[model samples]
Target: MAADELKLENQVCFALYAASRAVTSLYRPALDALGLTYPQYLVMLVLWERGPVLVKELGQALDLDSGTLSPLLKRLEAAGLVRRQRCAEDERAVRVYPTDEGGALRDRAMSVPRKLSGATGMGLAELEALRENLVRLTEEITAQQD
Candidate 1:
Protein backbone atom coordinates (compact mmCIF):
# COMPACT_ATOMS: atom_id res chain seq x y z
CA MET A 1 0.00 0.00 0.00
CA ALA A 2 1.20 3.50 -0.79
CA ALA A 3 1.97 5.75 2.19
CA ASP A 4 -0.65 8.43 2.73
CA GLU A 5 -0.40 10.51 5.89
CA LEU A 6 -3.79 12.10 5.28
CA LYS A 7 -5.62 8.77 5.23
CA LEU A 8 -8.24 8.40 7.98
CA GLU A 9 -6.87 4.98 9.00
CA ASN A 10 -3.40 6.52 9.40
CA GLN A 11 -4.61 9.27 11.73
CA VAL A 12 -3.83 9.11 15.44
CA CYS A 13 -6.55 11.66 16.17
CA PHE A 14 -9.23 9.40 14.73
CA ALA A 15 -7.95 6.44 16.74
CA LEU A 16 -8.00 8.51 19.91
CA TYR A 17 -11.48 9.80 19.17
CA ALA A 18 -12.81 6.30 18.51
CA ALA A 19 -11.19 4.91 21.63
CA SER A 20 -12.58 7.76 23.72
CA ARG A 21 -16.09 7.09 22.47
CA ALA A 22 -15.74 3.38 23.20
CA VAL A 23 -14.52 4.04 26.72
CA THR A 24 -17.32 6.51 27.37
CA SER A 25 -19.80 3.92 26.11
CA LEU A 26 -18.54 1.55 28.79
CA TYR A 27 -19.28 4.17 31.42
CA ARG A 28 -22.74 5.01 30.13
CA PRO A 29 -24.65 2.39 32.08
CA ALA A 30 -22.53 2.89 35.17
CA LEU A 31 -23.16 6.62 35.15
CA ASP A 32 -26.83 6.18 34.33
CA ALA A 33 -27.26 4.38 37.62
CA LEU A 34 -26.12 7.56 39.37
CA GLY A 35 -28.35 9.70 37.16
CA LEU A 36 -25.26 11.25 35.59
CA THR A 37 -23.78 11.31 32.14
CA TYR A 38 -20.08 10.72 31.47
CA PRO A 39 -19.40 14.45 31.38
CA GLN A 40 -21.37 15.02 34.54
CA TYR A 41 -19.46 12.19 36.16
CA LEU A 42 -16.24 13.93 35.17
CA VAL A 43 -17.52 17.12 36.77
CA MET A 44 -18.32 15.16 39.92
CA LEU A 45 -14.84 13.69 39.94
CA VAL A 46 -13.31 17.16 39.72
CA LEU A 47 -15.51 18.58 42.46
CA TRP A 48 -15.00 15.53 44.64
CA GLU A 49 -11.26 15.89 44.31
CA ARG A 50 -11.38 19.66 44.89
CA GLY A 51 -14.36 20.93 46.81
CA PRO A 52 -16.33 24.10 46.11
CA VAL A 53 -14.67 25.18 42.88
CA LEU A 54 -15.69 28.05 40.64
CA VAL A 55 -17.65 27.29 37.50
CA LYS A 56 -14.82 28.55 35.33
CA GLU A 57 -12.40 26.25 37.11
CA LEU A 58 -14.72 23.30 36.61
CA GLY A 59 -15.05 24.17 32.93
CA GLN A 60 -11.28 24.39 32.60
CA ALA A 61 -10.79 21.11 34.38
CA LEU A 62 -13.24 19.39 32.07
CA ASP A 63 -12.07 21.27 28.98
CA LEU A 64 -15.65 22.41 28.36
CA ASP A 65 -17.24 25.79 27.82
CA SER A 66 -19.84 27.54 29.96
CA GLY A 67 -22.41 27.07 27.21
CA THR A 68 -22.08 23.30 27.49
CA LEU A 69 -21.51 23.15 31.21
CA SER A 70 -24.33 25.46 32.24
CA PRO A 71 -27.07 23.07 31.15
CA LEU A 72 -25.29 20.07 32.64
CA LEU A 73 -24.94 21.95 35.91
CA LYS A 74 -28.61 22.72 35.83
CA ARG A 75 -29.39 19.04 35.43
CA LEU A 76 -27.07 18.16 38.29
CA GLU A 77 -28.71 20.86 40.40
CA ALA A 78 -32.17 19.56 39.59
CA ALA A 79 -31.06 16.10 40.63
CA GLY A 80 -30.07 17.54 44.04
CA LEU A 81 -26.48 16.52 43.50
CA VAL A 82 -24.95 19.99 43.25
CA ARG A 83 -25.69 23.61 44.01
CA ARG A 84 -24.67 26.62 41.95
CA GLN A 85 -24.40 30.00 43.57
CA ARG A 86 -22.83 33.30 42.67
CA CYS A 87 -19.52 33.83 44.36
CA ALA A 88 -19.58 36.35 47.21
CA GLU A 89 -16.50 38.31 46.17
CA ASP A 90 -17.24 38.01 42.48
CA GLU A 91 -20.91 38.09 41.83
CA ARG A 92 -20.31 37.47 38.17
CA ALA A 93 -18.65 34.12 38.83
CA VAL A 94 -20.60 31.08 39.90
CA ARG A 95 -19.34 28.52 42.37
CA VAL A 96 -20.41 24.88 42.26
CA TYR A 97 -20.63 22.98 45.50
CA PRO A 98 -21.73 19.42 46.05
CA THR A 99 -24.80 18.85 48.13
CA ASP A 100 -25.06 16.19 50.83
CA GLU A 101 -26.71 14.00 48.22
CA GLY A 102 -23.81 14.56 45.88
CA GLY A 103 -21.30 13.72 48.56
CA ALA A 104 -23.16 10.52 49.34
CA LEU A 105 -23.26 9.65 45.66
CA ARG A 106 -19.48 9.67 45.71
CA ASP A 107 -19.58 6.54 47.81
CA ARG A 108 -21.67 4.87 45.13
CA ALA A 109 -19.39 6.21 42.43
CA MET A 110 -16.33 4.86 44.18
CA SER A 111 -17.16 1.35 43.03
CA VAL A 112 -17.09 2.39 39.40
CA PRO A 113 -13.32 2.46 38.93
CA ARG A 114 -12.92 -1.01 40.33
CA LYS A 115 -15.89 -2.35 38.43
CA LEU A 116 -14.61 -0.94 35.19
CA SER A 117 -11.22 -2.43 35.87
CA GLY A 118 -12.81 -5.83 36.23
CA ALA A 119 -14.95 -5.27 33.17
CA THR A 120 -11.94 -4.34 31.09
CA GLY A 121 -10.02 -7.34 32.44
CA MET A 122 -6.83 -5.33 32.35
CA GLY A 123 -4.31 -5.60 35.18
CA LEU A 124 -3.36 -2.58 37.25
CA ALA A 125 -0.01 -2.16 35.50
CA GLU A 126 -1.60 -2.30 32.06
CA LEU A 127 -4.25 0.20 33.12
CA GLU A 128 -1.59 2.53 34.48
CA ALA A 129 0.35 2.27 31.23
CA LEU A 130 -2.77 3.07 29.23
CA ARG A 131 -3.46 6.07 31.45
CA GLU A 132 0.11 7.34 31.11
CA ASN A 133 0.01 7.01 27.33
CA LEU A 134 -3.32 8.80 27.10
CA VAL A 135 -2.14 11.58 29.41
CA ARG A 136 0.97 12.07 27.30
CA LEU A 137 -1.08 12.23 24.13
CA THR A 138 -3.55 14.67 25.73
CA GLU A 139 -0.68 16.95 26.83
CA GLU A 140 0.76 16.87 23.34
CA ILE A 141 -2.60 17.75 21.81
CA THR A 142 -3.12 20.59 24.28
CA ALA A 143 0.34 21.93 23.55
CA GLN A 144 -0.38 21.85 19.84
CA GLN A 145 -3.63 23.77 20.43
CA ASP A 146 -1.75 26.50 22.32
Candidate 2:
Protein backbone atom coordinates (compact mmCIF):
# COMPACT_ATOMS: atom_id res chain seq x y z
CA MET A 1 0.00 0.00 0.00
CA ALA A 2 2.84 2.40 0.83
CA ALA A 3 4.58 1.48 -2.42
CA ASP A 4 1.34 2.00 -4.28
CA GLU A 5 1.11 5.46 -2.78
CA LEU A 6 4.63 6.20 -3.97
CA LYS A 7 3.86 5.47 -7.62
CA LEU A 8 4.44 8.25 -10.12
CA GLU A 9 0.88 7.95 -11.41
CA ASN A 10 -0.44 8.76 -7.96
CA GLN A 11 1.63 11.89 -7.32
CA VAL A 12 -0.04 15.26 -7.84
CA CYS A 13 3.37 16.90 -8.28
CA PHE A 14 4.14 14.58 -11.18
CA ALA A 15 0.79 15.35 -12.74
CA LEU A 16 1.42 19.07 -12.36
CA TYR A 17 4.94 18.77 -13.74
CA ALA A 18 3.85 16.79 -16.77
CA ALA A 19 0.92 19.10 -17.43
CA SER A 20 3.19 22.15 -17.13
CA ARG A 21 5.64 20.72 -19.65
CA ALA A 22 2.84 19.75 -22.02
CA VAL A 23 1.29 23.21 -21.83
CA THR A 24 4.67 24.87 -22.39
CA SER A 25 5.26 22.67 -25.42
CA LEU A 26 2.06 24.09 -26.91
CA TYR A 27 3.69 27.51 -26.88
CA ARG A 28 6.92 26.38 -28.58
CA PRO A 29 5.90 26.72 -32.21
CA ALA A 30 4.13 29.99 -31.63
CA LEU A 31 7.02 31.42 -29.59
CA ASP A 32 9.51 30.16 -32.17
CA ALA A 33 8.17 32.63 -34.71
CA LEU A 34 8.63 35.43 -32.19
CA GLY A 35 12.19 34.29 -31.45
CA LEU A 36 11.28 33.68 -27.83
CA THR A 37 11.25 30.77 -25.43
CA TYR A 38 8.68 30.15 -22.71
CA PRO A 39 10.86 31.67 -19.99
CA GLN A 40 11.71 34.64 -22.20
CA TYR A 41 8.04 35.15 -22.97
CA LEU A 42 7.31 35.14 -19.24
CA VAL A 43 10.00 37.82 -18.68
CA MET A 44 8.59 39.90 -21.54
CA LEU A 45 5.11 39.59 -20.06
CA VAL A 46 6.34 40.97 -16.74
CA LEU A 47 8.25 43.81 -18.36
CA TRP A 48 5.35 44.60 -20.62
CA GLU A 49 3.04 44.91 -17.65
CA ARG A 50 5.39 46.58 -15.15
CA GLY A 51 7.70 48.75 -17.24
CA PRO A 52 11.28 49.08 -15.93
CA VAL A 53 11.75 46.97 -12.77
CA LEU A 54 14.71 46.16 -10.56
CA VAL A 55 16.32 42.80 -11.13
CA LYS A 56 15.46 41.70 -7.59
CA GLU A 57 11.83 42.76 -8.04
CA LEU A 58 11.65 40.98 -11.36
CA GLY A 59 13.01 37.81 -9.77
CA GLN A 60 10.47 38.01 -6.96
CA ALA A 61 7.62 38.62 -9.38
CA LEU A 62 8.60 35.65 -11.53
CA ASP A 63 9.51 33.33 -8.61
CA LEU A 64 13.00 33.02 -10.08
CA ASP A 65 16.48 33.60 -8.63
CA SER A 66 19.41 35.50 -10.10
CA GLY A 67 21.22 32.33 -11.15
CA THR A 68 18.39 31.45 -13.52
CA LEU A 69 17.35 34.99 -14.47
CA SER A 70 20.81 36.42 -15.22
CA PRO A 71 21.48 34.27 -18.26
CA LEU A 72 17.97 34.73 -19.56
CA LEU A 73 18.21 38.52 -19.21
CA LYS A 74 21.55 38.47 -20.99
CA ARG A 75 19.95 36.63 -23.91
CA LEU A 76 17.04 39.09 -24.09
CA GLU A 77 19.52 41.98 -23.97
CA ALA A 78 21.51 40.43 -26.82
CA ALA A 79 18.28 40.10 -28.82
CA GLY A 80 17.67 43.86 -28.32
CA LEU A 81 14.32 43.15 -26.69
CA VAL A 82 15.44 44.47 -23.31
CA ARG A 83 18.18 46.49 -21.66
CA ARG A 84 19.77 46.00 -18.26
CA GLN A 85 21.59 48.76 -16.44
CA ARG A 86 22.66 49.75 -12.97
CA CYS A 87 20.00 51.84 -11.26
CA ALA A 88 21.22 55.41 -10.81
CA GLU A 89 19.65 55.78 -7.37
CA ASP A 90 21.05 52.43 -6.22
CA GLU A 91 24.04 51.36 -8.24
CA ARG A 92 23.96 47.93 -6.61
CA ALA A 93 20.56 47.28 -8.11
CA VAL A 94 20.01 46.54 -11.79
CA ARG A 95 16.85 47.51 -13.66
CA VAL A 96 15.50 45.88 -16.78
CA TYR A 97 13.73 47.95 -19.39
CA PRO A 98 12.05 46.75 -22.55
CA THR A 99 12.99 48.34 -25.88
CA ASP A 100 10.63 49.70 -28.55
CA GLU A 101 10.99 46.41 -30.37
CA GLY A 102 9.95 44.56 -27.24
CA GLY A 103 6.83 46.73 -26.87
CA ALA A 104 6.02 46.08 -30.54
CA LEU A 105 6.17 42.33 -29.94
CA ARG A 106 3.06 42.58 -27.82
CA ASP A 107 0.91 43.13 -30.91
CA ARG A 108 2.38 40.07 -32.59
CA ALA A 109 1.83 38.02 -29.44
CA MET A 110 -1.85 38.92 -29.16
CA SER A 111 -2.89 35.63 -30.75
CA VAL A 112 -0.99 33.40 -28.34
CA PRO A 113 -3.71 33.29 -25.70
CA ARG A 114 -6.36 32.57 -28.33
CA LYS A 115 -4.23 29.82 -29.84
CA LEU A 116 -3.64 28.23 -26.43
CA SER A 117 -7.34 28.45 -25.59
CA GLY A 118 -8.27 26.85 -28.90
CA ALA A 119 -5.80 24.05 -28.24
CA THR A 120 -7.26 23.45 -24.77
CA GLY A 121 -10.83 23.59 -26.12
CA MET A 122 -11.87 25.04 -22.79
CA GLY A 123 -14.08 28.05 -22.27
CA LEU A 124 -12.73 31.23 -20.66
CA ALA A 125 -14.77 30.76 -17.47
CA GLU A 126 -13.57 27.21 -17.00
CA LEU A 127 -9.98 28.25 -17.55
CA GLU A 128 -10.35 31.12 -15.11
CA ALA A 129 -11.69 28.79 -12.43
CA LEU A 130 -8.82 26.39 -13.02
CA ARG A 131 -6.32 29.19 -12.78
CA GLU A 132 -7.83 30.39 -9.53
CA ASN A 133 -7.66 26.92 -8.06
CA LEU A 134 -4.05 26.51 -9.11
CA VAL A 135 -3.19 29.89 -7.62
CA ARG A 136 -4.80 28.85 -4.34
CA LEU A 137 -2.92 25.58 -4.34
CA THR A 138 0.38 27.34 -5.01
CA GLU A 139 -0.27 29.81 -2.23
CA GLU A 140 -1.06 27.02 0.19
CA ILE A 141 2.11 25.14 -0.65
CA THR A 142 4.31 28.21 -0.41
CA ALA A 143 2.67 29.27 2.83
CA GLN A 144 3.62 25.97 4.40
CA GLN A 145 7.26 26.64 3.57
CA ASP A 146 7.29 29.89 5.47
Candidate 3:
Protein backbone atom coordinates (compact mmCIF):
# COMPACT_ATOMS: atom_id res chain seq x y z
CA MET A 1 0.00 0.00 0.00
CA ALA A 2 1.06 3.63 -0.55
CA ALA A 3 1.01 4.21 3.21
CA ASP A 4 3.50 1.43 3.72
CA GLU A 5 6.05 3.32 1.64
CA LEU A 6 6.06 6.07 4.27
CA LYS A 7 7.54 3.91 6.99
CA LEU A 8 10.42 5.44 8.96
CA GLU A 9 12.72 2.55 8.12
CA ASN A 10 12.28 3.27 4.42
CA GLN A 11 13.45 6.88 4.56
CA VAL A 12 16.88 7.70 3.17
CA CYS A 13 17.10 10.80 5.35
CA PHE A 14 16.47 8.75 8.46
CA ALA A 15 19.22 6.31 7.52
CA LEU A 16 21.70 9.13 6.99
CA TYR A 17 20.69 10.78 10.22
CA ALA A 18 21.08 7.55 12.19
CA ALA A 19 24.45 6.79 10.63
CA SER A 20 25.72 10.29 11.33
CA ARG A 21 24.80 10.03 15.00
CA ALA A 22 26.41 6.65 15.28
CA VAL A 23 29.64 7.85 13.67
CA THR A 24 29.78 10.90 15.87
CA SER A 25 29.17 8.74 18.91
CA LEU A 26 32.02 6.48 17.90
CA TYR A 27 34.34 9.46 17.67
CA ARG A 28 33.41 10.74 21.10
CA PRO A 29 35.84 8.64 23.09
CA ALA A 30 38.76 9.44 20.81
CA LEU A 31 37.92 13.14 20.64
CA ASP A 32 37.36 13.34 24.40
CA ALA A 33 40.93 12.18 24.89
CA LEU A 34 41.98 15.38 23.08
CA GLY A 35 39.63 17.59 25.10
CA LEU A 36 37.55 18.32 22.00
CA THR A 37 34.01 17.61 20.97
CA TYR A 38 33.20 16.34 17.47
CA PRO A 39 32.37 19.83 16.25
CA GLN A 40 35.49 21.23 17.84
CA TYR A 41 37.53 18.49 16.22
CA LEU A 42 36.11 19.50 12.83
CA VAL A 43 37.09 23.14 13.43
CA MET A 44 40.54 22.07 14.54
CA LEU A 45 40.96 19.94 11.43
CA VAL A 46 40.25 22.97 9.24
CA LEU A 47 42.61 25.16 11.27
CA TRP A 48 45.29 22.52 11.10
CA GLU A 49 45.07 22.52 7.32
CA ARG A 50 44.63 26.25 6.69
CA GLY A 51 46.32 27.90 9.66
CA PRO A 52 44.68 31.25 10.54
CA VAL A 53 41.28 31.70 8.89
CA LEU A 54 38.51 34.23 9.13
CA VAL A 55 35.51 33.20 11.20
CA LYS A 56 33.22 33.57 8.20
CA GLU A 57 35.50 31.41 6.09
CA LEU A 58 35.57 28.79 8.78
CA GLY A 59 31.77 28.84 8.89
CA GLN A 60 31.57 28.30 5.14
CA ALA A 61 34.02 25.41 5.31
CA LEU A 62 32.12 23.73 8.11
CA ASP A 63 28.60 24.54 6.84
CA LEU A 64 27.93 26.18 10.20
CA ASP A 65 26.44 29.55 11.14
CA SER A 66 28.01 32.25 13.30
CA GLY A 67 25.73 31.49 16.25
CA THR A 68 26.82 27.83 16.29
CA LEU A 69 30.48 28.62 15.66
CA SER A 70 30.77 31.40 18.24
CA PRO A 71 30.49 29.15 21.26
CA LEU A 72 32.88 26.56 19.87
CA LEU A 73 35.46 29.23 19.15
CA LYS A 74 34.96 30.63 22.63
CA ARG A 75 35.51 27.24 24.19
CA LEU A 76 38.64 26.69 22.12
CA GLU A 77 39.90 30.08 23.19
CA ALA A 78 39.14 29.34 26.83
CA ALA A 79 41.03 26.06 26.57
CA GLY A 80 44.13 27.92 25.28
CA LEU A 81 43.94 26.14 21.94
CA VAL A 82 42.90 28.90 19.53
CA ARG A 83 43.04 32.66 19.48
CA ARG A 84 40.60 34.98 17.75
CA GLN A 85 42.12 38.20 16.51
CA ARG A 86 40.71 41.11 14.59
CA CYS A 87 42.00 41.17 11.05
CA ALA A 88 44.28 44.15 10.41
CA GLU A 89 43.04 44.63 6.84
CA ASP A 90 39.40 44.18 7.75
CA GLU A 91 38.81 45.21 11.30
CA ARG A 92 35.24 43.93 11.20
CA ALA A 93 36.34 40.38 10.53
CA VAL A 94 37.86 38.05 13.10
CA ARG A 95 40.52 35.51 12.20
CA VAL A 96 41.03 32.33 14.18
CA TYR A 97 44.50 30.92 14.65
CA PRO A 98 45.71 27.92 16.58
CA THR A 99 48.15 28.38 19.41
CA ASP A 100 51.31 26.37 19.94
CA GLU A 101 49.40 23.99 22.17
CA GLY A 102 46.73 23.50 19.53
CA GLY A 103 49.31 22.71 16.87
CA ALA A 104 50.90 20.23 19.24
CA LEU A 105 47.63 18.40 19.68
CA ARG A 106 47.80 17.48 16.01
CA ASP A 107 50.20 14.65 16.78
CA ARG A 108 47.83 13.08 19.26
CA ALA A 109 44.86 13.50 16.91
CA MET A 110 46.59 11.85 13.96
CA SER A 111 45.56 8.38 14.99
CA VAL A 112 41.87 9.18 15.04
CA PRO A 113 41.19 8.55 11.36
CA ARG A 114 43.03 5.25 11.43
CA LYS A 115 41.18 4.11 14.52
CA LEU A 116 37.82 5.07 13.05
CA SER A 117 38.58 3.39 9.75
CA GLY A 118 39.52 0.18 11.52
CA ALA A 119 36.28 0.27 13.46
CA THR A 120 34.26 0.63 10.27
CA GLY A 121 35.75 -2.49 8.74
CA MET A 122 35.59 -0.85 5.35
CA GLY A 123 38.49 -0.80 2.96
CA LEU A 124 40.04 2.50 1.94
CA ALA A 125 38.70 2.30 -1.62
CA GLU A 126 35.17 1.53 -0.46
CA LEU A 127 35.28 4.35 2.08
CA GLU A 128 36.63 6.75 -0.52
CA ALA A 129 33.80 5.82 -2.90
CA LEU A 130 31.22 6.24 -0.17
CA ARG A 131 32.64 9.64 0.71
CA GLU A 132 32.50 10.68 -2.93
CA ASN A 133 28.87 9.66 -3.21
CA LEU A 134 27.95 11.45 0.02
CA VAL A 135 29.73 14.59 -1.13
CA ARG A 136 27.82 14.49 -4.41
CA LEU A 137 24.59 13.99 -2.48
CA THR A 138 25.37 16.99 -0.27
CA GLU A 139 26.26 19.22 -3.20
CA GLU A 140 23.12 18.29 -5.09
CA ILE A 141 20.96 18.95 -2.04
CA THR A 142 22.73 22.22 -1.31
CA ALA A 143 22.28 23.38 -4.88
CA GLN A 144 18.56 22.89 -4.48
CA GLN A 145 18.62 25.45 -1.67
CA ASP A 146 19.91 28.13 -4.00
Candidate 4:
Protein backbone atom coordinates (compact mmCIF):
# COMPACT_ATOMS: atom_id res chain seq x y z
CA MET A 1 0.00 0.00 0.00
CA ALA A 2 2.94 2.28 0.61
CA ALA A 3 4.10 2.12 -3.02
CA ASP A 4 1.47 2.72 -5.69
CA GLU A 5 3.66 0.92 -8.26
CA LEU A 6 3.47 -2.27 -6.18
CA LYS A 7 -0.34 -2.34 -6.20
CA LEU A 8 -2.06 -4.72 -8.61
CA GLU A 9 -4.73 -2.11 -9.36
CA ASN A 10 -1.96 0.29 -10.42
CA GLN A 11 -0.36 -2.11 -12.88
CA VAL A 12 -0.77 -1.37 -16.59
CA CYS A 13 -0.23 -5.04 -17.47
CA PHE A 14 -3.13 -6.05 -15.28
CA ALA A 15 -5.34 -3.43 -16.88
CA LEU A 16 -4.42 -4.61 -20.35
CA TYR A 17 -4.96 -8.24 -19.38
CA ALA A 18 -8.33 -7.54 -17.83
CA ALA A 19 -9.44 -5.43 -20.78
CA SER A 20 -8.31 -8.07 -23.26
CA ARG A 21 -10.32 -10.77 -21.48
CA ALA A 22 -13.39 -8.55 -21.21
CA VAL A 23 -13.30 -7.61 -24.88
CA THR A 24 -12.73 -11.22 -25.87
CA SER A 25 -15.69 -12.30 -23.78
CA LEU A 26 -17.80 -9.76 -25.61
CA TYR A 27 -16.75 -11.39 -28.88
CA ARG A 28 -17.52 -14.91 -27.66
CA PRO A 29 -21.23 -14.94 -28.42
CA ALA A 30 -20.81 -13.40 -31.86
CA LEU A 31 -17.86 -15.63 -32.71
CA ASP A 32 -19.66 -18.70 -31.40
CA ALA A 33 -22.56 -17.90 -33.67
CA LEU A 34 -20.09 -17.87 -36.54
CA GLY A 35 -18.60 -21.18 -35.32
CA LEU A 36 -15.17 -19.67 -34.70
CA THR A 37 -12.95 -19.34 -31.66
CA TYR A 38 -11.14 -16.08 -30.95
CA PRO A 39 -7.84 -17.40 -32.29
CA GLN A 40 -9.57 -18.93 -35.28
CA TYR A 41 -11.30 -15.64 -35.91
CA LEU A 42 -7.91 -13.95 -35.92
CA VAL A 43 -6.49 -16.41 -38.40
CA MET A 44 -9.54 -16.04 -40.59
CA LEU A 45 -9.19 -12.29 -40.43
CA VAL A 46 -5.66 -12.55 -41.82
CA LEU A 47 -6.73 -15.04 -44.45
CA TRP A 48 -9.68 -12.94 -45.42
CA GLU A 49 -7.39 -9.95 -45.86
CA ARG A 50 -4.60 -11.69 -47.72
CA GLY A 51 -5.55 -14.76 -49.67
CA PRO A 52 -3.04 -17.56 -50.26
CA VAL A 53 -0.32 -16.46 -47.88
CA LEU A 54 2.77 -18.40 -46.90
CA VAL A 55 2.51 -20.23 -43.58
CA LYS A 56 5.54 -18.34 -42.32
CA GLU A 57 3.95 -15.03 -43.35
CA LEU A 58 0.72 -15.98 -41.64
CA GLY A 59 2.63 -16.88 -38.47
CA GLN A 60 4.40 -13.53 -38.52
CA ALA A 61 1.17 -11.61 -39.17
CA LEU A 62 -0.55 -13.35 -36.27
CA ASP A 63 2.53 -13.19 -34.06
CA LEU A 64 2.18 -16.88 -33.32
CA ASP A 65 4.99 -19.43 -33.34
CA SER A 66 4.87 -22.63 -35.41
CA GLY A 67 4.05 -24.80 -32.43
CA THR A 68 0.90 -22.83 -31.76
CA LEU A 69 0.06 -22.06 -35.39
CA SER A 70 0.44 -25.61 -36.70
CA PRO A 71 -2.27 -27.06 -34.47
CA LEU A 72 -4.62 -24.19 -35.16
CA LEU A 73 -4.17 -24.56 -38.91
CA LYS A 74 -4.72 -28.29 -38.63
CA ARG A 75 -7.98 -27.70 -36.79
CA LEU A 76 -9.12 -25.17 -39.39
CA GLU A 77 -8.25 -27.60 -42.15
CA ALA A 78 -10.17 -30.32 -40.38
CA ALA A 79 -13.15 -27.99 -40.15
CA GLY A 80 -12.92 -27.52 -43.94
CA LEU A 81 -12.48 -23.80 -43.51
CA VAL A 82 -8.92 -23.62 -44.75
CA ARG A 83 -6.44 -25.71 -46.72
CA ARG A 84 -2.67 -26.01 -46.55
CA GLN A 85 -0.53 -26.86 -49.52
CA ARG A 86 3.17 -27.06 -50.24
CA CYS A 87 4.47 -24.24 -52.40
CA ALA A 88 4.98 -25.30 -56.04
CA GLU A 89 8.37 -23.59 -56.34
CA ASP A 90 9.63 -24.38 -52.86
CA GLU A 91 8.39 -27.76 -51.77
CA ARG A 92 9.62 -27.11 -48.25
CA ALA A 93 7.41 -24.05 -47.82
CA VAL A 94 3.70 -24.29 -47.10
CA ARG A 95 0.89 -21.90 -48.03
CA VAL A 96 -2.55 -21.49 -46.49
CA TYR A 97 -5.73 -20.35 -48.19
CA PRO A 98 -9.38 -20.30 -47.30
CA THR A 99 -11.81 -22.74 -48.81
CA ASP A 100 -15.07 -21.78 -50.48
CA GLU A 101 -16.88 -22.14 -47.16
CA GLY A 102 -14.31 -19.98 -45.42
CA GLY A 103 -14.64 -17.20 -47.99
CA ALA A 104 -18.44 -17.31 -47.56
CA LEU A 105 -18.02 -16.83 -43.82
CA ARG A 106 -16.61 -13.41 -44.54
CA ASP A 107 -20.08 -12.08 -45.34
CA ARG A 108 -21.37 -13.20 -41.95
CA ALA A 109 -18.29 -11.77 -40.25
CA MET A 110 -19.02 -8.30 -41.55
CA SER A 111 -21.22 -7.55 -38.55
CA VAL A 112 -18.77 -8.73 -35.90
CA PRO A 113 -16.68 -5.58 -35.72
CA ARG A 114 -19.68 -3.31 -35.76
CA LYS A 115 -21.22 -5.32 -32.92
CA LEU A 116 -18.04 -5.18 -30.86
CA SER A 117 -17.56 -1.51 -31.56
CA GLY A 118 -21.11 -0.80 -30.44
CA ALA A 119 -20.50 -2.79 -27.27
CA THR A 120 -17.51 -0.57 -26.48
CA GLY A 121 -19.87 2.47 -26.47
CA MET A 122 -17.16 4.44 -28.26
CA GLY A 123 -17.56 6.48 -31.42
CA LEU A 124 -15.81 5.27 -34.56
CA ALA A 125 -13.16 8.00 -34.47
CA GLU A 126 -12.50 7.42 -30.77
CA LEU A 127 -12.20 3.69 -31.31
CA GLU A 128 -9.80 4.24 -34.22
CA ALA A 129 -7.61 6.55 -32.13
CA LEU A 130 -7.53 4.01 -29.33
CA ARG A 131 -6.60 1.25 -31.76
CA GLU A 132 -3.83 3.40 -33.23
CA ASN A 133 -2.42 4.07 -29.77
CA LEU A 134 -2.50 0.36 -28.88
CA VAL A 135 -0.73 -0.56 -32.12
CA ARG A 136 1.95 2.05 -31.46
CA LEU A 137 2.46 0.74 -27.94
CA THR A 138 2.77 -2.83 -29.17
CA GLU A 139 5.21 -1.89 -31.91
CA GLU A 140 7.40 0.11 -29.53
CA ILE A 141 7.53 -2.67 -26.95
CA THR A 142 8.17 -5.33 -29.57
CA ALA A 143 10.98 -3.25 -31.06
CA GLN A 144 12.56 -2.99 -27.63
CA GLN A 145 12.37 -6.77 -27.20
CA ASP A 146 14.11 -7.30 -30.54
The most accurate candidate by lDDT is 3
Location of the lowest summed lDDT over 10 successive residues in candidate 3: 1-10
Compared with the true structure, what per-residue lDDT tens digits does model 4 show for residues 38-92?
9999999999998988889988998998898889999999999999999999998
- Runs in model 3 lying further than 4 Å from the true structure: 1-10
Query: In candidate 1, what are the lDDT values of residues 95-118, reduced to their tens digit?
Result: 999999999999999988766877
Candidate 2 per-residue lDDT, tens place, 1-146, comes to 87877785568788899889999999999999999999999999999899999989988998999999999999999999999999899989999999999999999998887777788877889989989999999999899998
TM-score of 1: 0.89
In order, what lDDT does every prediction score? 0.90, 0.92, 0.94, 0.91
Off by over 4 Å in 1: 1-11
The best candidate in terms of TM-score: 3
Error of 1 at 21 (Å): 1.4
TM-score of each: 0.89, 0.91, 0.93, 0.91
- State model 3's lDDT: 0.94
Model 3, position 18: C-alpha lDDT score: 90
- In model 3, what is the error at residue 8, expressed in angstroms? 8.2
Ranking by lDDT: 3, 2, 4, 1
Each prediction's number of clashing residue pairs? 0, 0, 0, 0
Residue 114, model 2: Cα distance from true site in angstroms: 1.6
